[model samples]
Target: MSLKKLISIFFLISNFIFALEIQPTMFEQRIDGSGGYREFIVSNNTNSTLRYKLTIFPGSKKDRDMSKWTEVSPKILTIKPGRNGIFKIFVQTPKEISDGEYDYTLSLKTMDLPKLPGETDKIASAAKLNFDFRLNFIGYAGDLNPDIDFINPVVSTNANGKTVISGTIVNKTPKRGIYCAVNVISGENSLNYSEIRVPVNGEKQFSVTLEPNVKKSDITGITIRNLENSDIILKKPI
Candidate 1:
């Protein structure tokens, strides 16, 4: 997809009732000899004290579990109102691991501010909007894979009120997951395009959004391909 087409696909409308501000929504890089460490800054703006818990999830259950190789310092932390804190995460490379790209999700979830220690808050407060933030990790261990399969695509509106071509993407490759652009088509004309990725040997639901100007009735197909090689990986009519 061209730069113009790429920008058109991610026309997102965010209605975030936010409380905690986290920086660097996603991380993509290679792990150096020192360690592949990342730091995220969190700012608590709400009146209540917020506790964030850090957890890592593997991209695909079918592939090797790399979640165990990650280290998150201060797995759970408490930040008072108007205070800022940081969470550091780094990869602890395992022995004899495959030199390829690895995919994982780092999630930060907020816990309730109880009135007392070791006590649960029974009363719900709507003013404090608890949130779960998912930060994507696309770490290049050394290299990666390019296999992808698009399945069962259909037109739907996402939670953010965007029109999208929803479907499943399967990374059937044994060692590496892929991140790439998806082209939505109405016959030969490219309707719009969006990005998607699946963990190595794992499947994930995808929503390749149609640009606001495109009519839903006109969408007829989905395309996944290698732009560099002009290779069509999968092209299916919805």
Candidate 2:
């Protein structure tokens, strides 16, 4: 198979593993409104009951100063060989955090456990759960209207009577997006459909063709939107 196919398969399996189980089964929250707070969870999937420490930190440079902001919560959980445990944390989310999306990583590790016979010192099996925490203060708010401008929004026909349309995307938002679907709507009905993705701050080209003898006049523009909810349309008559 092609390298592209291999990469796709790799990402698919990675995502599946991520959703299979929660490493830390429990969490405790302490906060003043939306200010800073501590969060913790413990997972015990090993033979012996292990002592652990959990830390949640900012996932960006602006949050790097968080070294001093760290909070050491009380020892929280006792994970049996088969079950996980929970821990409480202290955190603060200031009122100014209600603008866009924020990302964070919750790091969990075995506390300074004494070295065991023939055991490695590495405490964490994997990095803490990394995820983008989006705080949309605007609420469900109305969906923003999207404006799409294709890089090469033109269709070319060949002697064999095949029509191919190609184009690119220019996202004008601070947020990244992934294109989910493409629809070729003609008048009241859609003539052709496809699923495609356009990475954030990037462009992609797709070719859609009609059967031999199908005139271009029957085709309308194509609409492209992201899985994260952004839309762009390519007009044909233009």
Candidate 3:
């Protein structure tokens, strides 16, 4: 191979080798009338030390800001080779605050690692490649009163010959959000369909497919229940 080609390949390999790894890419926390906190684990898998900066931002486009209620500890973290570090996130809800669901994105970005003396310019530039990891954080506050309704559920078949149910989940409550599983019952066969989260006073469209052997005519009812509390939010005949 040509010398130039070898150098390009070397830089590409180095960039891939230094990427960061994080655990629990997505997490949810419930802050009732009282406040609560959560933690995430970040590991340094590269050969050299790793430095990262943690920041919080609104997770959804509709969310304007979350800094007032959400807090992250140790914004800057350093981990030795093969070592792990922890990032703690805390959410505080005042008593006057309304009950609802809030979303935030916890982002960890790698700082530029120092280059060794006498390193080639090309290698140094490649080593400057930084990696970013983001975790979707969902926070719920106040009394947990989630009202979910299944609307206009229809059964169909997908290209894979699996039974599919399509519909919308409406959260009627003005201050509560719900994350739950949709269960479709057909006589003696009960199939757990899709799991979804509907924000406060919002509705979300969902489609879930069952096994090929599950027939559309066999589906008799659909029920939605809270995953955490197993509370039945809505049930309807299909």
Candidate 4:
């Protein structure tokens, strides 16, 4: 199909919104009551004027809303064609807050333009588009590290007639959630690989299928690697 359609499909699968390009879609750092801030840029690539708005939503419980301690300056912005706008994010931890991880979803939406008069009667109207640009915000309270453990793992054939390895991976730390990658090995070769996220003090189910060329009997085990440093978190033998 068209190149634009292909890009849209890829972005949809990756859970990303294609809009005015923004740098640093994720923010993760150590925060305290003293307050800290970060600055990012919004690049306008189109010929028309770009107007974007940012909103922070709670990703946790009502009592754990992180929006209370966070501030995004100039939430609404307008940039000329082919220009960039900079915005700063400031956050502060409360003294009464417990030592742990906090997170929120920051969404960016492009404002719609007003409809022109007498345009639709003679010609097709321009489609008004709205994009949900989600930015992940993660803040850590105190000293913390990622600790992921593989529970029980087993191999079996899935309904699609493919060799599947399934099990549970738990985050043993009370610090914060972690993004990790897992490599499934068979004998001396890597059969499959995938990325996963484990919530703080929570567990997530993982199911990965081996390559078609893999021999099931030679399956060795799995290795969990840190996405940031690529450190071997754990090696589980089955």
Candidate 5:
């Protein structure tokens, strides 16, 4: 190939290699009426300096407009090669806000710099290779009074041939629900314990396998407790 063709291929490959990277792509945050904050890191993995603009928008599962209550510092960032930038996010929730989960997206758009007049067409084309990185953020706010109930508890075997005690937890309250512990007892002895979380007014399915040497008939009772205070919320007999 000619020198120009070789140069063109080099620019194409280089542009693909010099891409941006973000850490902790997905995260969840709990925000009371008092407001809360989170931090994110953006790194420029390319050899050349890069410019980025940050913006917060509603995520696909957004039940309410959360952007209005969100504050992002340093809307614009410039980072050198192998350098990282820090972004701080603050969520301010009003006291009267209803109890529920809100979803939002943090977007980082790479700004494409203009090419010099004498730059080759291939190099200029490569400069247009811009990218956008997005992170999903779910924030929960307001009074968290999650009421959990267990439904249709049963013992079954999974494809892996393990005995599983499957059941569902229904959250009747509007607040997010977290399961601190699940206790299973049989013949006055504890069988299994598990921890899980459930969304506000949502239902979460759970499965816990019995230990070796323990049969389905071993379980006599079951109970679930809240994570915060370890208060028993649900109890039933097997």
Candidate 6:
């Protein structure tokens, strides 16, 4: 579906909440190297107990219309005032998922709440909603799934007797990616570094050299920075 159309649906869905918020406690799907179980965490951010329907976009716009997201639990749950609870949703990847990145969305929607004795309107105004959220899954074909791997401690060498540093970067997303810059810091010594880009399922190499006469022990560590996030200590040797 077109990006504009997809966002419109999210707009409508989020507008219905009343006096409550719904969102993933943690929006990212974290896959360990263990068996193929994918997990998601959802949270309620308000004082009153909340009810929600968890849905997964099976694939394509068609799957969304089919109502394929299986609910993680049936009985309604309660969280004490000023506290939060956890609900786990476990999904098993099919043995034969096509050999590439797959895209999907996990959504938390608030089921309608019963109205007060005299209340006629059912929809809650946006201001009253505590939380609204969406999670996107981008699966990649590499060992670590390009979706989450960010390599730091780029390669470096001596340049004209100066310190130079740089290294390759890969975008682990299943979809196309844009160029991102790395953030670096040097100790009292001058350390030079540059940024590089990698495509989806792709990798690039870069280098930065240290100042002339700079010794290894004088260096502490390198920090890698991206616009959306920051990663550091790519390499540290005493």
Reference-based TM-score of each model: 0.46, 0.37, 0.61, 0.61, 0.53, 0.43
- For residues 137-208, what per-residue lDDT tens digits would candidate 3 score against the true structure? 676666666677888888999888888888888988666566777888887667865678777778999887
- Of candidate 6, the 10-residue stretch with the lowest lDDT total is 26-35
In order, the Cα lDDT scores of the candidates are 0.65, 0.45, 0.72, 0.71, 0.71, 0.43
Estimate candidate 4's alpha-carbon lDDT, on a 0 to 1 scale. 0.71
Query: What's the lDDT for residue 119 in model 5?
Result: 52
What would the per-residue lDDT of candidate 5 be over residues 22-77, giving only the tens digit for each residue? Answer: 65443445566567676778787655566778998887665665777888889988
Q: Return whichever of 2 and 5 wins on TM-score.
A: 5
Judged by lDDT, which candidate is best?
3
Give one digit per residue, the lDDT tens place, for model 1 in 116-207: 45422321242234567776676656544467778777787666666777888887756656555678888789876655556667988877
Model 1, position 85, has a per-residue lDDT of 88
Stretches > 4 Å off in candidate 2: 1-147, 229-237
Candidate 2 lDDT, 137-215, residue by residue in tens: 1011012223445566666787777766656655543333344457666676666666654433556676678666556
Task: In angstroms, give how far residue 32 of model 4 lies from its true place.
Answer: 3.9
The prediction achieving the highest TM-score against the true structure is 3
In model 5, which runs have C-alpha deviations exceeding 4 angstroms?
1-19, 61-63, 114-127, 143-174, 177-238
* Candidate 6 accuracy as lDDT: 0.43
Which candidate do you rate higher for TM-score, 1 or 2? Answer: 1
By TM-score, highest first, what's the ranking?
Answer: 3, 4, 5, 1, 6, 2
lDDT of 6 at 63: 22
The residue-by-residue lDDT of candidate 4 on 133-224, one tens digit each, is 77777776766667889988888876666788889999986778777788898767777778877878889999977766565576889999
Which should have the higher lDDT, number 1 or number 2? 1
Query: By the lDDT metric, which is better: model 1 or model 6?
Result: 1
